[model samples]
Target: MPIPTSNGHASRVQIQEPRTRSPLPPSSSPIAFKEQQGRPPPAAQQTIAGKLSRNLFKGILFSQLTLISLLVIVLTIRGLILASSHHFHPKKWYPPLLASVAVSGVASLAWQCIFIYNPPRAVKATFWLTPILTCSVGILLVLIGSAVDAGIGAVFVLFAITQSLYGCWITPRLEYTDKILSLSTAFPPARTREVVSLSILVSVVYSGFLVTGIGGATSTRTNLDLLFVSVILISLAWTMQVLKNVQQVAISRARYVNFAHGEDMDAWGAFRVTVKHLIGSICIGSTLVPIIVLIRGSIRSVNLMSGSSDEVMYSGADCFSTIANKLITYGNRCGFVHVGTYDKGFVEASSDTWKKLRSTVGLEKLIDSDLTSSLCFLSAVSVGAVSSLTAGIWVLLIHKDYALEVTLYAFIIGYFVGRVALAWIQACVLAYYVAYSEDPQSMRFDGTIPNRIQRLQLLSARRDNRELEVGRDRDDTDNC
Candidate 1:
């Protein structure tokens, strides 16, 4: 029963496969019986509607509306203060703002189309091509940035190079390459158009936030102005995070409705559920991830820029912050799956999600996509690098002083767009995990994974047995 695994060790893993079946031998295929069972459980019913109908706003007053109010207040204060001055005009934001919106919308739709056509290829290409694009683009930008001295050019180059190298290093080490590749396009493709439109809507709203962001960032002068700008940027970032999470909730709901309840729920219908019932919980859920990320970035930036005498302390702080962010982000994602599935508060949903994951597949199996995650980050950074380069070049040509401002805006917008494009994969994964956890033995969830894994196990078993036979022959020779 012991089989060598990818970790180069043998373990007695009793394969839960090769289930008893009729008409054909069990040796024919690893998943012959269960693979044919594709329909949802008979137990799933319309009672889910009753569970979903309740008003489940957990923290609207303190979380979602508060971010909205803060953004408005900061924007109003900035507008009033700058009413008399011609120094920082919103008119200057027009071109880059339009550019960001257009790029974001087009890039998102295009990426969605790519996935629609071939999910496996898209996933594979993202892992392989994004790194090359990132490295190539990084080197090009580094050359241009060094020559032109454009402000955010240095940041873009560094991000590109770092993300590219990380992606290249991680891809080859991925364990379940075939499993993830097959799982990539396995979702029923009924929910494409609505999600695409929702993304477009998010991109437009994102541009609105960027407009205020563009104005505030370029207009900071006094300490008060700086405070106002920081609040505005942070609030905008939070809103952007909320929008993405909303889509995530919608995708989970859509999958649940289609598969579990045997009903149809398009992106907009699921969006309505999210906007109606889950907005407040989502707002609360979205709050910590972005805030922690902002804090982590601020810490890293401070440490890197300080050129601190005590490198040890700075290094420790940076590592600590980064680890904390990753832990929180991973927990938050699993938690949101529970939130989307049931009408529970953020904390309660997240708690239940952990219990379910631990009891079912364990945390290691669910969150072990290091290569996929790295590729996504690198792809987003690559998009940001392209945006930064294009914006920087234009700004340097026209008005070099504000080149940093425009490039930063472009990078944020481009990165957001890249994330939006990749959102469906994340949504499918979480939804699949939730569905699988609900009915582990019988759930018709991602059939491809089981088959591929069975094949790997068989191969590993054969390899291990061969090695044992060779060892026995050597021992016999030594005895003779």
Candidate 2:
């Protein structure tokens, strides 16, 4: 048949029978078909088909309790076995333990002096209170751990002890700091409760890992070796999660401190965001772990191959390890900066952090201040040492046969608890640094920005203006 066209030319129209459809090749599976369709595989589809419901708080509680239970059982069994097999001598360990306590106290005092030297009057109390709280919590936890038998009751008693101590002592002091820092203006009751709850959850997880590690150390079973590995992995996972939460809290706190409107994001909401970005954050954190491990491994291999018993080899390795550790730590601090880049993609946040750290007048030094990190460590160490000493004395007087085991347990538990207790304070310090970096003028030092930061801001502004002028002048000349 022919159809007439608009140009007066006749065009032929042909019709043909429809061809049969060919089936997919035998080798092509359903998965392949889905892939061709840009869809997920059936298994994956089914995996996520159910309603996405994860109660993080409940999960945290369950995991913490379960881990604590396992740890207590293992420790209890180990203690029983040790008591039956070996005799403990309190006099043998007493001198070294006491010496350790003395050294820790001296070191803590020295570090505190470095931290508080010529510090602003406003933050002086904050710095002072941190060590005090750390010591108090550490001592209290050790006392509880030493007094109570390893059981479910022990867990409850520990929590009750912590709650009573925090409420009676720490909370009031923290409240005073809140008033000093005007934190109430930023943190409503709901927000404060969320922060406190999350902090407690993190503390529970940290304490569980610590207890598990200590318990595992007393056993030499193959099963415990496996369990130790599991504990390490789980601990790392929880640590990463806690660090991410800290970043979110830091950002929120910074916003509140700056009087930003609509900054009242709930803790659950922040946690959800953290979960959404968990993979990316883990990838960022994990990259450093492997590199550090590989470097240390390589150094060890070189030492073995060289067979050089020289001090130079050891010193070099130590130096490299320190550098690697600092690099990793700096990377961690950068995570908080990434948090400050609100709603930005992970790549962009990482890039921005890199740029800032590389900047000549940037906040790298301020954010990675030795005062913040060292003080926390020293505080924990000091408290742990003192707890060890106390446990030794108690064992000497009461449980003379179980002196070594109890003292070791107290020292390890106390140190971990102390560190976890101060984690919130560290978050706040990071938040302050972030706020200052974002807007120096917004930070309140006695109700006004600090003179040094204000001057730095002015200098930065002027430098930016000059760069703009230079760029514009070059553009005008190029046009001519």
Best candidate (score: lDDT): 1
Model 2 worst lDDT run, 10 consecutive residues:
8-17
Cα lDDT listed for each candidate: 0.55, 0.42
Candidate 1, 444: how far from true, in Å?
2.0
Candidate closest to the true structure, highest TM-score: 1
**Tens-digit per-residue lDDT, 119-190, candidate 1:** 456556666666455444444444444455433345545655665566567554454543452343243335
lDDT of the structure predicted as candidate 1? 0.55
Clashing pairs in 2: none
Worst 10 residues of 1 by lDDT: 1-10
Q: Model 1 off-target regions past 4 Å?
A: 1-93, 128-155, 173-192, 216-220, 257-264, 289-330, 361-363, 370-372, 446-480
lDDT of 2 by residue, 393-461 (tens): 666565454455545554554454445444444555445444444433332423322433354467778
